[model samples]
Target: MGSINYDDSDVLDVLIIGAGISGINAAYRLHDELPDKKYLILENREQLGGTWDLFKYPGIRSDSDLHTFGYAFKEWTGADIAEGKEILTYLKKVAADNGIEERIRYKTRVNSADWSTEERCWFVSTEQDGQQKQYRSRFLYTCTGYYDYDAALKADIPGIQNFKGKVVHPQFWDLKEDDYRGKRVAVIGSGATAITLIPSMAEVTKDITLVQRSPTYILSLEKYDPIAKVLRAVLPQKMAAFVIRQKNIARIYASYHIFRTFPGVAKKILGRLTSMQLPKDIPLDPHFKPNYNPWDQRLCICPDGDFYKTLREGKAHIATGHIDQVTNNEIILKNGERIPCDIIVTATGLKLHVGGKIATSVDKKLIKASERFVWKGCMIEGLPNYALSIGYTNASWTLGSDCTAQYVVRMIKHMDKYHKSMVVPEPSNRDQLEEGPLLDLTSTYVKKAEKDLPKAATTGPWRMRTNYWYDLVQAKYGGYDELVFQ
Candidate 1:
C-alpha cells in the first residue's frame, strides 16, 4: 500500500475506526475529557450499531444482560436481555446525545496505516465511494471488533451446494429475502446463535431443528430483576442504577468464580437443569451433556425458561449427531438418521481477525499482529499512540469499553502535562514464562484463530485477562511506572 500525499495542514488529533459501541464510547470520552482535540470516526458500514446493526436474524439479541452491557454513564431501564434492533437504537441515541454523530464518516473503509518515527504520527489510506484517500492523525483509536465482517466461520460440510433448500448464515439474515414461515428449518451449531434462533424461529417456522456435534452449557436467568426495579422506584435514577449495577457486577464475579471453583457441583446443577427442561423420555447424556467444565465456553440463557418451554411444546428439537451430508430435501446424520428440512441456517461462528484486518507498519517494517503481545489487553505491545477496545469475555462488553476509553483519556492527560508525544508499554520480563494465547475462551471462533491472535505475557501489564474488576484496576492505575514516554 502506497501513502497518500497531502499537505501538513491535513492532520488531526485523533482518528477512530468503526462507529460501533466502543467507537462511540471513545468519541464521547474524548469530547468530554479532551474537547480541544480534533477527531474523526471512520466507519466502513453504512450505518452504526456495529454487531447489533449487522445481525438481522429474527431472534437476534444479546446474551448478556442490559444492566452491564449498557454504558456506565447510561442506565439501562429496559429488559435484562434486549433485542438487536433495540441495541442499535440505544447506540444511535448515545451518539446523538453526545453530539458525536456529526463527526462520523460513513462508508469509509481503511486499507492500511503506516506510522512514522520522524513525523510522530500515522498516515492512513482509506477508500470512500471507490476512490482512495489519505488522512493523518497524531493518535489512532480502533474499536473495530476482532472479527472478519465479510465472512463467517463455516464448517466444510460435504456438498453444501447440493442442499436443495435455501442456505444462509444467521449473521447475514435479511427480512426482504428469506422468511422461515411454514418451513422446516435446520439450524446447525449449538452456540449462542443457535440457542437464540431456535425459540424465536419456532414461532414462525413449522418446526425447527438444532443439530449439534456436541453440547454447550445453557443456563436460565430471570428476564427482569426485582431488586433493580425496586431500587429504581425508590431512589434517584443514577444512584439507583449505580447500586443495581454494582450488585449485578458482584453477582457476575461470584458466578464466574463458582463455575471455576467447583466444576463438579456446577456440572451437576447444569445437568439437572437440562434434564428438568426436557421430557422424561428424552436422554440427556448425549443431547444436553457437555464434555467440558462450565465457563470453558460461554453459558447462554433466555428469560424464564422460554427455551425449555419451546422444547417441551415440540416446536423445536435438538439433534445430537454428526452430519453425513446434505441431500436435496434432507440432512443425513452419521448415525443413519435423516432430518427433513426446507432451510439450513449455518449458525457456525465468526472468523476472528485481530486489528480489523488493517495492514499496519511502523517505519516500513510490517507489524505482524501475531508476533507481538497485547498491552493490558488494549494496546499493541510496542505500539505508541494507539489503543484497541475489546470487552470482557465473561461479563458485559461495555464494562471493558468504558474502563479502557477512560483509561486512554487519562493517559492522554498525563502525557499532555508532561509534554510527552508518545507512550508505549513493553513487557518487562517475557522470558520468565512461556507466552500463552491472548484469550482463554474455548469457543470455536477463539480456537480457530488462536495461532493468528496476539500472545500474552504471563505476568505484568502485558498479561491479558477477562475479569472486569481486575482489569479495571490494571487499566486505571497499573503499568504507569513501566510505560516509556517520549
Candidate 2:
C-alpha cells in the first residue's frame, strides 16, 4: 500500500510491462544476454498472449504468417497462419520453456511510471490484487502494444439502437454465451477483423452479410505454406525456420515495394487474382475493388481463399454502401437497398492507445509522447532508460519487435559496461529535421491517433524504416551518438 524504495536488493534491474509478443521477446533477450540482471514482467491479464488471449471471436487468427510472426529465438512448427488458440498455446510454451513464466506477475496493471533524476531509477505505480503497489527498476520497458485493450474504435451507425436484434462488437464477443446458430448476421466494416469474421461465422449462421462503407484491398493466400514444408524436409527445424522466415520477409518486402512503385500495374495484377477466385456474380467494382492503392492500408488476407470460397458456396454476401438506418430486422443502405439480419457484429477498427494508457513523467513533469521523436525506432527523445516496442506495418509484428528487444538489450549492456545509470535520447538539431508520423500507414487508426503518437524524422537514426532486413543490421550495430549517457 505504500511506496517502495530502490535503495537495496528489493529493486529490479529491469521491469517489463505486458506479456505480449514484444514483452516476451524482451524477457528472453534480457535473460539470455544479461543473465545476472534481475527482471520481472507485469501482465495485466491473468493469462499470457496479449492479443490472442483478449479476442475470443470465432475465426480469430494471425493475419501475418507464424514463421515471421513467431520469435526469432524460437522455431514455429504450426501452420503459417494459425488460429488464436494455437498461437496462444505456442506463446505459453515459449514462456514455460524459457522460464519466463516464473518471472511474471499476473493481473498487475501499471497505472503510471515516473523517472527520478536524483535516484536514477523508475518508480512504477501499479494495481495488483485489488491493492495499490509500487516497484522500482533501473530501466522500464513497455510492450503493451499500440491499441487500447479496454475499448475499440466506435463507429457512427445511424438507428443502430433501434434494432431489436442483438448487437455485438468483435472485441467484446463471448464465445461461451453468444449463440448464432441458424441466425442471419450482419458484420460491419471491411478491415481484417470483418473479413476474418465473415468466413469464420459463415457455416454456422444461416446467412452472413459483410457490410462495409467502402472496399479495402483483399488478397487470398495459401494458409499452409508449401515452401516451408519443403524447407523443413531438407533442413533442420531451427535452420528451416530461419530460412522460411527470411523467405517470407523478402517476399512481402519485394511485393510491398512493387505495389508502391507501380501501383497501376500492381492493382491490375491483384484485381485479376482476386477476380479469378471470386464468383462471377460478385463484381469486382462495388465490393472487391478498393479506392486506395495497394499497401496504402493493410491488405486483408484470407487464408486459402476461404472468404471467396464462402461467397461461392452461397454462405456469405458483401454489401458496400453507407448505412442509412438500421431497422429491427434489416439495415437500410443510402441507396434504399436493404439486408435483413438478426445479429449485428460491429468489427470496427482498433483505437490506438500508446504506452498502455499509463501516464509517464520525469521529475514530476508529464512526458508528452506526441512531442517526442523516436530514437532508433525504440527509445523516445528525452526519455531516460525507457523503450517501447512498435512493430512494422508491412511485415510481421515480431520481426520489428525482436529488433527493438535486441536493441534495448544492447543499450542496457552498453550502459552497464560504461557504469552509467541513465541513457537518454537527445535529438541533434531537432529544428532542422523534417518530422512526420511514426507509422507510414494511412489507416483510420493511425490517422485518429496522430496527435497521441510520437514523431519520426525523415533522416538519421530518428527515422523508422519499414524494412526488416535493414532494421536487423542497424539495430545490432547502430550508432548511439544521439543518446546522452549519464
Candidate 3:
C-alpha cells in the first residue's frame, strides 16, 4: 500500500485511539504532564465507554471492583461491582471533566497505520462519516483493547442454523428488538459473563439454563462495602476512599500470590467459600466443582450472591456436556439429553485482537505483530514513537494502563529534553531471550489466539508482568537503559 494524503489533515503530537478507560487515563496523564502537546482521540464507535457501552447484555457489570479498575487520579465513590451503565456514565464524566471530550472524533474508524522512518511520524488512514481521511501523529497510543467488535468468539456448535429459535451472543444483544420474557433461554459457557447473565436474565425469563463445558471458580462480595460506609461516615470522603482502595489493593495482591504459590490450599478454601453461598438443597460437587485450581483462570465474581440465589430458587438450571447438535426447538447434548430452548445465548467469551484491526507497516515493510516482542506489557519491540495500552490480566486492567500512560509521558519528556526525534526499545540480545505466551492464561480465547499474540520474555523490562507496585517501580521510576533515544 502507498501513502495517502488529505488536504485538511492536521498533524498532532499524539493520537490516542479508543476513548475507553485506557484512553481517558492516557488523556489525563498527557494533559497533566505535557499541557502543550497537541493530540486527538479517534474512536470507531459513535460514543465512549468501549466495553461498557458496546456490551448491552443483561446483568452487565465489572467482574473486578472499581477501586483498581478506576483511574489512579480519580476515586470511584460508587459500588465496588458497578453496573455497566453506571460504569459507562463514570467514563463519560471522566472524559468531560478532563476536557477531553471536545478533542474526540466519533464515528472515525482507523483502517491502517503506517510508520515512516524518514518522517518520524505515523500516517493513519481512516474512514469518518463515509469519507476517506488521513491524520499524522508523532506518537500513537492504542487503547482499542484486544478484542474484535463485529465478531465474537463462540464454539462452532453443529447444526446451529437449523435451530428454530433465535441464537445470540452477548455482543449483539438488543432487548428492545427481541424479548426473552416467558422464554426458555439457554446460556452457554461458564465465564463471568455467562454467570452474570444467567442470574440477571432469569429474573425476567421463564426458565434459563446455563450450559457449560466445565465450571469456573465462583466467588462473591457485597455490592457496597460496610467498611467503606463506616470510614466515610467518620473521616473525610477523599481520605476514606483512598484508604479503602489501598486496603483492597493489598488484599487482592496477597490473594494472587497465595493462590499461585499454594494452589491446593487455595482451591479447597475457594470451594468451601463457594459452597457456603448455595442452599442446602442444591448439590455442590456436580455443579460448583471445577477441576482447575483457584487463580488458574479468572474467578467468576458475583455481587451480593445473586447467581447462587438464582440457582437455589430453581429459576435456572445447569447442564454440563458438549453439544451434539441444535435441532429445530432444542439443543441435543452429547449425553443424549435434549434441552428445550426458546433462545440460545452463546456467552462464549470474546476473541483476542490487537491494534483494533489496523493494518500496520513500517518503512513499507508489513509489520507482523505476532513475531514481535512485548515490552513492559505495553509497547512492542521494533516499534518506536508508539505505545499500546494493555492492562494486567490478574489485577484490574487500569492499574497497568495507568503505569504505561505515565511511562509514555516520561518518554516524551525525555526525548524533548535530548532533542531526539525517535525513541525505540532495543533488547541487548533479542535471540537469547526466552519467550512464552504474552498472556500466561489457560482460557480458550487466549489459547485460540496464541499464534497471533506477542511473545513475552523470561526476565527484565521486556516481560509483561501483573504486579501493581512492582510495575509502578519498573515502568514509572525505572531507568530507560533498554530504550534507544535518537
Q: What is the lDDT of candidate 2?
A: 0.89
- Candidate 3 lDDT over residue span 45-78, tens digit each: 9998999989989879999889778876888889
- In candidate 1, what are the lDDT values of residues 1-486, reduced to their tens digit? 112233434698889999998899898888887887778889999998889888888778888888999887878888888888888899899888877888888899999998887898999999988888898998888889878888888687777789888898887786432367889999999988899988888988888999898989888888888888899999999999888888999988898889889999999989998888787656898988999999988888777777878898888988888899899998888999788999999998888886778898887788887988877788887777888887887888888887778888888888899999888766677567468778778988899999998788767677766788877786678657557899
Question: Top TM-score: which candidate number?
Answer: 2
The C-alpha TM-scores of every prediction are 0.96, 0.97, 0.96
lDDT (tens digit, per residue) of candidate 2 on 119-205: 999999999999899999999999998899999888899999999988988888964423798899999999999989998898889
Clashes of each: 0, 0, 0
Best by lDDT: 2
Ranking by lDDT: 2, 3, 1
For candidate 3, the 10 contiguous residues with the lowest summed lDDT are: 1-10
Q: Give RMSD to native, each candidate.
A: 3.6, 3.1, 3.6
Candidate 1 Cα errors over 4 Å, as ranges = 1-9, 175-178
Candidate number with the higher TM-score (2 or 3): 2
